[model samples]
Target: MTKSKQTEWNFDNTYARLPKSFFSDTNPTPVNSPELAIFNDQLAESLGLNAEALNTEDGAAMFAGNEIPEGASPLAQAYAGHQFGHFTMLGDGRAVLLGEQISPKDERFDIQLKGSGRTPFSRGGDGRAALGPMLREYIISEAMHALGIPTTRSLAVVTTGEPVIRETELPGAILTRVAASHLRVGTFEYAARLGNVEELQVLADYAIKRHYPDIEDNEDRYLSLLEEVIKRQAELIAKWQLVGFIHGVMNTDNVTISGETIDYGPCAFMDTYDPETVFSSIDVQGRYAYGNQPLIGGWNLARFAETLLPLLHENQDHAVELAQEKISDFSNLYQSHWLKGMRAKLGLFNEEKEDEALINDLLSMMKEHRADYTNTFRALTFEKHDDTALFGIPEFTQWHERWHVRLSRQQESKDSVNQLMQNSNPAVIPRNHRVEEALEAAVENGDYSVLGKLLDVLSKPYAHSAEQEEYCAVPKSAAPYQTFCGT
Candidate 1:
C-alpha cells in the first residue's frame, strides 16, 4: 500500500464519527495504473487545496485511490432509496467519501471519489466507472455551477488504466467529487428502516448541525428542517425548469438534503422546448420528464417527510397531518419560485395577475413552433426590430404585441429590462449533442481539445460571444434524445 500522500487537503472526517451503522469504513480499491486526466485548479483553490501539490503524480495517486490523503477516513455511506417509485436498498455501490475538507474560512465540504472501486454496497455489479461518463459529469456539473445553479463541483478525473464491462469493455476512470454534504433524503429513510428512533434522531441532529445550523436549537427543529429542505428543493426544481435542465432520474437517494443537485448520471438540458422531454433511457414512462420535475420533487419530499414521522410528534395521526401540511406547501412554493424566474426571463419586474399568462403564452408558442429554449429567450434580448424575422410568426407576433403593451406599464428603463433578461437567459447550455460530441472525441480519439473549448464557452453561460455561436444552436432533429445512467 502506498503511504499517505502529503497533499494539501485539510481532511476532517466528521461523518466518520457517526454510529458505525451509518457507514462502512473502507478504503477505495486501488487500480493498476493511475494517470491524471483533468484537474480543476480553481475548485482546488476554493477548497483551500494546494494546486501545485494536486497537479503532480502524487495527486494522481491520491485521487485514483492508490494512496489515501492524510487525515482521511474513506467510507461507503449506507442509505436506501426509491428507484423509479419502487423502494429498494442502495448505498455507495461505486463510490467512497474521502472525508471532508475545511477551508480557511471554515466552510466544510466533502471530497468523494466516484468510480473509484467497489465497496460493501457494490451488490452484484462491477463498481467501475467509464471515462466517457466521468468526463460527461465533469463537463455538465461545471457548466451547472457556472450557470449559477447549486451543484456538486468536479475536482479531478483520473484514468484507471483498466477496462470495465458494460455493453462492452470501456476505459475505466475515477471522478473526484466535492459537495456540501452527501446526507440525503434516503439516508434518513435508511435510519428509519433500521427501526431505531435514537439513530434517526442522531442522523437528524447531525444533519441540522452540518447543513442547517441556524435551527439546531429550535424546539421543533425537526419540523423546521423538513420545511427548510422543502423550500430549497422547491427553488431548486424551479431553477432547473428555468434553465431547461432534466435530472433524468429523480430517485429518492439522489435528492440531497442540502438541496444541491447531485448524481449527474443521465442528466441533460433540453435543446428545444417540449414538456414531454425525457433523456434518461431507463425512464421509459417519463416519470421525470422536463415538465414533471416539480411534481417528482414533491413526491421525493413526501418520502423524506415519511421518514421523519417517528420524530414529528407523539401521535401518529397528528404527525401524518403535520407532514401532509408541509408536503402540501410544495406546489404553491414551487409555482411562486418558478413564476418569479419566468418573470425575470421575460424582463417583468412588477407582478400582475396577467404576468403569468403572458409568460405561459410565450412558452406555449415556443413549444408549438419547436423553438430553441435557450436561443428563443436569448433572441428576445436583441433589438426587436432587427430580429423581427425570428419572432415574426403569427402567434409570436400577437404575443409580442401584448408583451409590448405590458412593458409600457413598467417603470424600468428598456435597457434595464433588457439587461435583466440577458442575465436571466443564458447564452450557452450543455447541449446534449455538443456534450456527446466532446465525450466521443475524448473517449474514442484521445482528443481533449473539444472538451476544453466547450468548458471555456460554458464558463461564461450568460455572456455573448459571436465566435461561440455554434454552441448555441439547438439539435436539428426533434427525435427523442436519450441519456444513459452509466452504471
Candidate 2:
C-alpha cells in the first residue's frame, strides 16, 4: 500500500503537528472497485482543484481510498460526546481526514472521506457508509449552502463496488466532505477529561489562531472564545428555527466551534408547523425535538464552557462565575436573532414593541390549524389573502386583519415588505418525502434524474413559481415520519 505522489491538492498539515493524542494516523481502506458517481465542479473550482483531473479513473481511485494523494497525512480524529444525555468516547469510526488543503483564496478546509473505511474507533462494527445516506448528505448539505446556511459542503461522492450490511445489504459509497475546520466542542472535552491542562491550553490556542485570530492577543482569550462560540451557536440555532430545520442530533461532537453545521445524519426540514416535532427515530424521548433546539444549544455550550474552565481563569470559582454569566446571555441573543428573522418572514420591515406578540400569534394559529410551515410564510408574499388557501381559516382571516392593520402603521412600502418576506421565506426545501424517493430511486434502481430534478428546484429556494409548486406540497403519508442515523 504505497502512497501515490501525484495530486492536484495543495496540502497544509497543521493539525497533524498537534499532539499525537489528538488523532490516529491512518489511511483510508481501499474499496474492491471504485467509480466516481458525482463531482461538484463548481465547488472544485472554488477550492482551486482541477475538476477535469478528478473526473477521471485516477481521480476515482484517489477518492475511493485505493490511492493516497501526495502530501496527505490521513488520520482519525479523537473526540467525546454526550449522546442522548449519556457521555461516551467517540472518534472517526467510519471517516478519515486526508489533511487540510489551502484554497487559492488562502482559506483552509479539511478534506475528509466519510464511509471511507474502518478505523481504530470502529467499535466492533463495519465502518462503511451506504450509498443512500452518502447521497442524502450530498443533496441536503448542498441545498443548505444554497439556502444561505453555514454548512459543510460535499466535493465528490464515489461508489464502492461492494456491499454494506445495514438493515440489509446496501451498496457502499464514499463522500468527500469539505469544512472550514473539524474542531468541535468535544475535542476540548476529551483533552480536559485526560486532566492535561497543557494539552488543553495548546488546543485552545490552536483553536483561537485557526478560527478566531482576532482574539489571540486578548488576555481573556479563553473566556472570549467561549462567549464567541455561544453567540455563534445561538444565531445558528435561530437560523435553523427560522428555516424549520430539525438537526435531530445536537450532541456536543456534532456542534462545531467553527459555527458551521456538521454531520447531516437524521436531519430534516419541517413540512408542517409543530413546535414539538421530532423526526429522528432513535429519539424516543424527543430530547432533540424542534422546539428544544435552543435550550439544547445552550446546554451543549455549557459543556463546552466546562472544558475551558481551567484556562478561563486562574481562580476556579471566578471562572465558573464568568462562564455562567456568558451562558445566561444566550437566551437574549437567540431571542433577538429569532425575532429579527420571524419579523422579516411576516413582511414587517420596521420593528415594533407588539411585533413579538404579532408573530407568535400567527405561529400559534398555524400550529393550531396544522398549516404548512414553508407555505404559510411563502403565502404572506401574495397580495390577496384568499389567493393563499392555507390561510383560509376564520382564525387566520381574523389574524390577517390584525396583520394588515399592523402593516399599515409601518412607513415602509408594501412592495418592499413583500420583497422582504419573499426573500426570507423559501419556496422549496429538501422535502423529506422527496428526499426519500430520490434516495430510493438512485440506490435501488440507479435512476438519478429524479435526484437531479430535486436538486435543481432546491438550488433556487427563494424563487416562487408555478413550475415548482408541486415541490411546495407536504407528503400525505398516513404513518408518522421518521429518519434513521444510517450508522
Candidate 3:
C-alpha cells in the first residue's frame, strides 16, 4: 500500500519584503552528505506536509541542505543583541530559515535549519552544529512542549554524514526548528539603531498581522502589539521559573517577540531548589539564573520598548513616558501568573491573601534544605510520609510538615488535589546530568538507546511509570554534571 501524502504547505513569504538590511539573501550551505536521524511525523502532518515524501530522497535532499524547496525563500536573518549585558552585532550565523509553513490551525511557523552550513553572518566560525547539541535540542524542546510551555518546536534532526570539530572530532548534525516567527526583540533593536523607523514599523506591522491580527483595527496597534508582546514574555518567563528552567543565555536576540522560548543553548532544569542556579558555562555572572529570569525578561522587554519608542507616540518625551509606563506592567503581570502557577504546583486550592508569602516560605525552606525541586513535588503527589525515601535528607521532614499544614487549608478533596498536583508537577524533567549522559553515549559511543529512552520518558513526564522510575530520581552527588553553551 502507498503511504498518503499531506502536501498542504501553502507557502507565503511576508518578511522577505522588509528590505535587504533585514536579512542576508542566501541559501543554506549544502552539505556534502546528509542522513536523517529523526522526523516528527505528527508535526509534519500538522504542517500539511507529505510524511512519506519527507522520507524519500527528494524530501531528505530538501531538508539536508542539498536542495531548496519550491517557493522556499531561504535566508539568514540579521540583528544585534546584548550578550551577557554587552552589546554586539549578531545574526543567524549558523541557521537559515527555509520559509514559513502554515499549520492546519492557520498558525505560521518558520521552518529553519540550524547548522545547515555557513552564511555571510558566519563571522569566521565554522557554521556547523555537533550531533549532541542537535539531539539535545530535539529532546529538550519536545519535553518543554509536553510540559505545556510556549516554546520553539523541533520538527526534524539530520546528520550531516560527516564530522565537525569542537573540543575534539565529533559527528556533525542539523536541526529543523519551528517557531511562530523568528523575529526577536533584537530584530527591532537593529532597525532602531540604524535610525530606520520606517523599517521598524514595517517589522512591527508584519508581526501584528502574523501573531496578533485583531490588534490591527486599533489606532495604536503598534503600541498595543508591543504591550502584548511584553505581557506574553512576562508570563512565559514566569512559567519557566515555575518549572525551574534556566535559559542560561537570555540575550535580546534570543528573546522572541512571539514569546515562545527560543535558542536552547545551555538551558537546564533545576535538580535542587536554588534560586541562583547557573548552568551555562559562558554565564560568568548569574545574569540568566533561575531566580533572575523575571528581571532579565523585563530588561529584554525594555530594550524592545526602546526600539518601539519612535513609533509609539508623536513626541519623543511622550513616547519615552508611555513606553516606561507600559514596561512597568511587566513585573506585576509576571508575578500574577507566577503566583497562580506556583499555587497549582503546590496543590493549593484556597486563595489566601498571604498565599504569595506562603509559597515563598516553602521555596526558602527548600533552598535551605537543598531539596530536589522535581522530586519534592512528585513525592507530594503520593502524599506519603514513608516515601520520604525520595527526599533522602532528614531535614526535608521539617519542610514537609509545613507543606502538609498548607495543604490542610485547601477545601478540595485530598485525593482530587493530589491528582491535580500529580498532573501539574512532573515526576521527571530533562535533568542536566541525564542529558549529558545521553549526549556522551551518542557522541562518544554512538549508542542512541539511552537518548531514545530518555526522549520517551520525557514525552510523558508527569505519568507514573514503573519501568522508568530511575528517571524520577535526582542525580547522586558522585554523578553531578553541568551543561555548556554550545556557542
Which numbered prediction scores highest in lDDT against the true structure? Answer: 1
What's the count of clashing pairs in each model shown? 0, 0, 0
The residue-by-residue lDDT of candidate 3 on 1-487, one tens digit each, is 1222234445667777778889988788888677777778877888888777786655666677787776778899999898888878888899998788876787788989899888898998789998888988988999999888999998888888788888888788899998989999888888888887788888888889888898998999978998899889988998898788888899999999888999997888998889988888787778888889999999989999988888989898999999999999999999989988888888887677877876777677678877788777776777754443435555556656776787888788888787778878887789887888888988788788898889889888778778668887776674544677664
Pairs in clash, predicted candidate 3: none
Q: Which regions of candidate 3 are displaced past 4 Å?
A: 1-8, 386-408, 478-480
Error of 3 at 330 (Å): 1.0
Q: What is the alpha-carbon lDDT of model 3 when measured against the actual structure?
A: 0.83
Segments in model 2 whose C-alpha atoms lie over 4 Å from true places: 1-7, 384-390
lDDT score for residue 125 of model 3: 76
> Per-residue lDDT of 16-131 in model 1, one digit per residue for the tens?
99999999998899999998888999999888888888898889999999988888999999999999999888899999999999987899999999998889999996888999
What's the true lDDT of residue 361 in model 3?
72
Whole-model lDDT, model 1: 0.91
| Candidate 1 deviant stretches above 4 angstroms | 1-6, 384-390
TM-score of 3: 0.94
